[model samples]
Target: MASSNTTLAEASNITTMAGRSNSTEAASPYSFHFGMLLNPDYLLVEAQVIFSALSIIWLGAHASLRRPPSAAHAKPKNGKKKVKDVQFAEGFTASDAIMLPVTAAIVLVGLYYALEWFKDPDIVNRVLRIYLSTVSIASLGAAAGHGLDIITSLVFPGLWVDRKGTLYRVDSDHQHQVKVGEGDVETEVVEIKTPFPSFLSTLPLSHGKIQAAWEIRNLLTEEWTVRLAAHGLGLAEFSIKLNTLLGFLIAISTTIAYNTTKWFFLPNLLGSAACYSSFSLMSPTSFSIGSAILVGLFFYDIIMVFYTPYMITVAKKIDAPIKLVFNTGRGVSMLGLGDIVVPGMLMAMALRFDLHQFYHKQMKLEPIDLVSELATATPGETVMVSETQYRRVKPTYADPEGQWGNRFWTTKLGSLSPVSIATSVRAATAFPKPYFYASMLGYFAGMLVTLTMLLVFNHGQPALLYLVPGVTGSLWLTALARGELKDMYGYTEDGSMDVEDVIVEVDSTGKTIEAVKSTAEEKGETKDNKTGKEAVARTEKGEGDYDVFLFSVTAPRRRAPKRD
Candidate 1:
């Protein structure tokens, strides 16, 4: 450690005329790590530390906001039933963390080597490059429009359907254990209905916009086209065709124009918007999956980037729009889509978790703890809770900042005595929420580290290698220092209660319904997806609204309730 620190300090020296002219310059491996005014090496280090520290602050605020509506230890009267808290998703389990990474590694190996095997196919590579570029451009456009999609879904009523009708899951099948004195809680079905005026009057022209666009499209179809052609009205038909074709032509022309830049400022700016959307929507159900992906990619990044120059070679040769490219006057600099995307996954997750936290606060409810069933756990005792069995049950507590604390401890000591291990037992930790914000801060810190590494190495560095530590280090350290490590480590998500009736992207592999295809002439039609056979159009709402409804209609299920 001391030697490494010395190396870093030595690297921080600015390249000067005196140093450059020195006779000993020939022996140096690098010009400078960070010779700039701030010394980026230290700056990068400080970013990791400071951002993580900020996360802890937000973690405390989020935790306090999410404090269970009812005190955990609150007492109940004799006849009172158990108050079941809402169960959201669980954190990653130990096995999942391991398995996900292994799978990703296998996949990455296949992709990397396949490119090498097909490296000689000049024609095939060209075809793929063009195709990928097109997709990237389109995705960028879609991403740019995604925010608008959400906004339109609001004004354009039929764009989204609240099948569950914004109902709340005050309780779910995955029960949160609130102590019961003696009797069962009143299981009488609780019906909650919320109505809001997202009505036509709010935005009067939303209907007009849809109607106008529809009319314009219909003018080019057989109904209008044939009528004009049959009457020998070639001029009218030609005018209509030209008008319709103009928009289509422009869209294509714009894509080609963007591609022709050979990666200038616009491509990077546009591509980033798409990348951001993709990252934000991916919620991590398991830290196991997130960890596996991050760690495996960490080594993969280093190997492909540094051990060999394969990654650099691919980026240079591909000529596809798979990365963000910038024209720095002298030349181009690039950041792969993965660099923006992978870390963004966690950043996005943080945002989602934040929204989730906000939902609890807005509703005046407690953030659900799914592991409440095992509330009373001891370090040395193995408790079978639910289908999952925890090997060691430790006392539940939070860090001093009142955040989810790590609670994992080693049971067996070899040089380690039983129950007396010297090293810390690294375990997975999860929190109800607010904890996710810390991870986000850590992500920013990691990104800075990645940038600093790029500057120092004067080549590519696998971002995850830096990021996994930046995000996880802060989470683990803050949690560990507060003596809440175990609680932080053992977090789980019961994804069964995830939001059901949200918009789906037809282009992406998500369960959300983009659109349901059905013939209005057919009766009692249905669409079977991964979930099961679901009715395409509810009979009552009928054909007109079905065309606009973006969410899938499945059998009634528990959902995380929403606030108006």
Candidate 2:
């Protein structure tokens, strides 16, 4: 297989030669056109197409991964999952079906515009505006993805959740700790105020306690004021400020990438290569590179649409230490915009200077010269190529049509030769790890074949045969990556927790009810100052209120598999 370095080295030589040839003399009929490579519009068109594909794949991934929970108790009355009619946890609710894709679309738009404006938005007077817009788009995409997950868990109560029925006693903490009896501990109830509910209710992926509070506030606005005023209230203002910072970073990097490069092909390739290179510099790991590329690609497509909203939601829900959770899940030092920058710049330069034709010329290839070549071959042309053209185009030693060269093309066959079958069979048998490893092998084989064709064409004909690999590989890999993520994280409709269940208690002291439940009316009579002592004593002697609610939740028993 040809390494990127080899292809690049060859490309450099081609560039030098093409430059000399183009300048020294008049253009030859066989000379390649360099202008096609520099077309900025192609870059934009490619980006749009790929991003559009990503939006579809993301929707597909959502449908595949966070599948609706089973309706064991709440039957699908309308013969469907009734996604909008379901509610599972305290803070989660059934979101509109349109809401899911809309979130993704928003992210997509953000990415599109981010690439458009931020790519070159000079950091002058309105730097903040550019920054804000960029951050907003990225945050929206992140938030939408996460929010959709939260909503999915909410609507499909049967989805993964761990700690249910967990009880927390606020008043008990304040209860006087006094030894009541032998070998027993009791609290002296000096002030019998109703115990505030426990801080935690639902089991969030991270920062369950704090997130529970925000989730309650966001989804249950009616209970927000009361819930916030309850115990567990601390610093809210600072948290918002922190979230804005995260949004800022995400936005800025996205803008830089968009403004720097017209197309993502090189960025995707190089970022993926570098990502895999980290796992084993000498031996690239497919999953590492593939996941990085796929995730970035999906995230890239959704960047403009969902990243910001998702970031807001994540920032809110991440009531835990921002540094920790961010570093752990989404913010882990995974490949970011920086990884794409170098490649993006390389592509920009290549496009700006029409470098591809140089690479082709260096390899002895010709350029696509006419509109006819751009279109699919006509039936007559196809027949001619399949029959008479083969003899003329044979590498060498073609005497009439009955020779060895004629024999090679006499039998009608697809582009693939017998070597393809042999290579495929060998690749399948060579991998012992998983089917994906086999897939990686197949992908490499396909790339090798394509590269070989590019080399041969550049050496001989030089027509643009690159059309084959570019379109096929991009779409194929995108679909494959989405499918893999779905298979790994997807839920089933058979009411079962694939992971372990965490049992938490729910009693009078727990916040589960108060977080979502409404209030009741109470009446009392008051007298004058003469009854001050009596009133104070009565108020101090208030009884602690407690209620119990119990249910089960499924939490991950072990670290979930990230990649294969």
Best by lDDT: 1
How do the residues 170-272 of candidate 2 rate in per-residue lDDT, one tens digit apiece? 2222321121222212323222122112122333434454434333323321111111122233212111222233434543555565445544332332222
Where model 2 places Cα greater than 4 Å from the true spot, the runs are 1-64, 68-249, 256-445, 459-564
Q: How good is model 1 by TM-score? A: 0.43
**For each candidate, what is the lDDT?**
0.38, 0.26
Count of backbone collisions within predicted model 1? 26
- TM-score for candidate 2, residues paired by index: 0.20
Q: How close to the true structure is residue 72 of candidate 1, measured as C-alpha lDDT?
A: 28
RMSD of model 1 against the true structure: 20.1
Q: List the RMSD of every prediction in angstroms.
A: 20.1, 29.8
- What is the per-residue lDDT of model 1 for residues 313-429, given as tens digits with 9 covering 90 to 100? 444445444554433222233455665555545444443444343333332211222242443457665654543211111121111111111111112213222111111111112
